[model samples]
Target chain A: MAAGTTSSTEVPAKGAGFPPFKTETFPSQIFWLVITFAFLFVVLWRIAGPRIKGVLVTRRGQIDGDLAKAQSHRADAEGASAAYQSALAAARGRAQALAEENRQRIGGEIDRAKADADAAAQVEIAKAEARIAASRGEARAHVAKAAQDAAIAIVARLTGDTVAADEAASAVRAVTGG
Target chain B: MAMNPMEQFTIKPIVPLHIGGYDVSFTNQSLLMVVVAVAASLFLTLAMSKRSLVPSRAQSMAEMSYEFVANMIQSSTGEDGLKFFPFVFTLFVFVLFSNFFGMIPGSFTVTSQIAVTFALASLVILTVIVTGFARHGIGFLKLFVPKAPLALLFLLVPIEIISFLTRPISLSVRLFANMLAGHTMLAVFAGFVVLLGGAGGVLSVLSIAPMFLIVAIMLLELLVAFLQAYVFAILTCIYLNEALHLHDHH
Candidate 1:
């Protein structure tokens, strides 16, 4: 095998020289290299390059748009929350005011009712006093009449004779007066 | 059989064809070049055919490669340098595919040839020179003139010019030498394994050493393949940056 390889290489080296350094192969190698390289360059430049660039550009645009949309949605949510808070505060204030007004109105009604009751009680007390004074005066007159009758009767019985009615009456009056 | 490692580097004519006076025969090297170009194109195009907003696995790979090259250019050459994105992308993908495909057994490594690497390096330097001259005119020559004392300018300027002129040579030699050396080393070690295994006796058992070494080197070669491609693209970016910016730090 060694001898075979040596003979093969020797035969080639004699005629064509070392393969990599051989001037004969330079033109062919360069020729094909130029052709293939140019073909690749054209493919990349015209077709593949633009495709990749487009995808990248599209992705960037999509990401930016999504971010902007997210920002707007967040702002909307914040606005809604703020409005809800303000509305709740207004409702709370109105409820408190209504409660306070009701309290003051009810208190005023209680005070007016108490004053009316007190005035009505005072009038009833005055009427009861006047009635008691009139009743007492009438009772005193009845007692006096009873006492006069008893005196007249007793005098009549003791004298046993018909005396003047006027005289008896006058005597009773005088005693009572004295 | 004692295989000659240099045999793998030979360019045999696959199709004999002549154009006028030149022997433009399609060889194994040419076939691999076409394959690389076609494979690269297909990988990129087919992967992105869906154009999915949420990329699939293949799509992600395609996009990743695209972004990788794009970012490299952007960082090295700045935003304005993006105009040469297609050119840079082509160079990267082509060289990357060539190196990777060559790793497969029985495949030719197009980038292993000095002629091929030299052509690519020449292309980069040519683009730089044309762009520099078109953009800055005579001011582009000021790149060779460093900010130094008048006494040192005479010395420094010549050195800078020579270095500038050797850019293509260095760039080409770096890639070509790396590929050639790596492939040759792998072949030599593989040859050892075969030769030892055929010897019989304890030598057959001892073949495991070279076999293990070959695996290690293969893994290293894979890394080198990727690194060399990245290095080539980044260097192109650096050269383009120099042309575009001249003396500006950015």
Candidate 2:
């Protein structure tokens, strides 16, 4: 139930005053307020406050550590890439050197084989020249024997006498200039 | 049907107790204060029980509120102001929960009482004065002295001192008046609905008007509740900033 406003004046009579302005309740309200508020402050300061701060600090430290780990991983990857590239280049240089050496060796072998074939052809030409000279000398001697036989037959028929073998030979020698 | 709008602000003692001849009885006001404190504590503590690297929905909410207050203090008072973080955080949560809980119909709005608001405001001002003196020693008095000429110092100094003295009054009155006025208006409109509805015939139908108005006022009150709490916390920060860094504003 609601209480009616007392009298015409703004102030209400005793025990019916505006509840907010009532002085009697002040001590109790302040007393309890102080107690509850102080309790709350202590709870927050001791328990809740430290817990929150710890969580936040831990999260920050973890993030920093993770970032540092990521940075090192990236550096390791880069180093590996550089090493791989250098190894590939060295391998390529070695292959080229091997190819160049093989080409030079093959070129020298081809030049030596050509020189041996040229010297064998020169020896066969000298042997054929020597055989031709010997054959020419034998042919000239056969032609001189045929001429002497023909000269002896002609003397026998004309003089009706046989000439001496030595004389015939001398005659033949003089004519042919042997 | 004609109810007194002021009836909602009444303080009835739930459990009577006499301590040293003073009436420190447990009242409805006291009940809500305990509830607010417990609820705020549980909200933060239970939500953070897991303490996972990645937060859950409840945990995120807890963290967000913590960071929200933390950032507010940081921006206004800088990092050094963070030393008072627990105090500022408690004040914000208490006022916020009290306002929200009061929105539930039939629940008491503790901040509406001048005693409670005044106590809170006084605590803030007192902290400011103490911190200023502790940090700067005698230099704290320089807060009232401006960089003006010698002749204008006399006039400006008094004005500054008066404003400084009235900080608690203004702070307390702002929250109390807003809550009291808003609640009172809601009560009055709700009373109008009952009155009009009981008048019978066409008057009953017209009661819908006041009912709609009540809804609108309620929405506004919700906004007011949050705004007042924010205003209280921010003003506290600004005052603390002044105490911490006197003459830095110039």
lDDT of each: 0.90, 0.87
Q: For residues A33-104, write the lDDT of model 1, one tens digit per residue.
A: 999999999999998999988887888898999999999999999999999999999999999999999999
- Stretches of candidate 2 off by over 4 Å are A1-15, A93-178, B192-219
* Model 2 Cα lDDT, one tens digit per residue, B176-244: 999999999998888889888999999999999999999999999999998999899999999999999
TM-score per candidate, in order?
A: 0.85, 0.78
lDDT score at residue B179, model 2, on the 0-100 scale:
94
What is the DockQ of the complex in model 2?
A: 0.32
* Best of the candidates, lDDT: 1
List, residue by residue over A12-115, the lDDT tens digit for candidate 2: 34367788998999888998899889988887788777777777777778888999999999999999999999999999999999999999999989888878
lDDT tens digits, residue span B138-193, model 1:
99999999988999999999999999999999999999889999998998889888
Q: How accurate locally is residue A144 in candidate 2, as Cα lDDT from 0 to 100?
A: 63
Residue B227 of model 2, lDDT score: 90
DockQ (C-alpha based) per candidate is: 0.42, 0.32
Q: Candidate 1's error at B174, in angstroms? A: 1.4
